[model samples]
Target: NLRVHLLEVEESVDRVFSDDSTKKAVNLLYMYPNGVNTVSSDIQGLTESSTNLGVVTTLENSIEYDSTARSS
Candidate 1:
C-alpha cells in the first residue's frame, strides 16, 4: 500500500532475475500497485515488461483518472 513496498517488490524481483531473464522480469514489472488514485501515479524503476501495462492501469482507473505521470 506504500511506494516503499512497491520499490521493495521491484528490487526483490530485480535481484532474482538475470539480464537474460526477460520473462521473470516482465512478470514482476507488470505487477500493479496496491492503492488506487484518481490521478494515476508515476511508476518508475520498472522495466518495460508487459505491452499493456499502461493500458491495464488506464482501464483500472478511467481515462480522466488515469495518467501515468500524474499523481493522486
Candidate 2:
C-alpha cells in the first residue's frame, strides 16, 4: 500500500515538471565531454589551493595526455 502511494506521488511530481521551462530551470549536474587534456586534483573537503593538491595529469601535446586519469 505504501509503495503504491509513493509511485502515485512520484508520477504526479513528474507531471508537474513535464514542461520545457521547468526542465530549463534545473541546472545540469554534469559537465560537457571534451577531448582536451587537463590536470586534475582532489580538492574535496580541503581548504588548500588546487595547485597544492599536485598535478594528477597534464597534456603532453595537442593530441596526447602526459598522464592518464588512473595514473597516480
Looking at model 2, the pairs that clash are none
Q: Show where candidate 2 strays beyond 4 Å.
A: 1-6, 10-18, 28-45, 48-72
lDDT of 2 by residue, 1-72 (tens): 012132334333322433563344332211222232334457444333221111223233212212223222
TM values, all candidates: 0.20, 0.19
**Each prediction's Cα lDDT score?**
0.36, 0.29
How far is 28's C-alpha from truth in model 2 (Å)?
5.2
Candidate 1 C-alpha error for residue 15, in Å: 17
Under the 3 Å rule for N, CA and C atoms, how many clashes does model 2 have? 0
- The weakest ten consecutive residues by lDDT in model 1 span 58-67
lDDT of 1 at 57: 29
What value of lDDT does candidate 2 attain over all alpha carbons?
A: 0.29
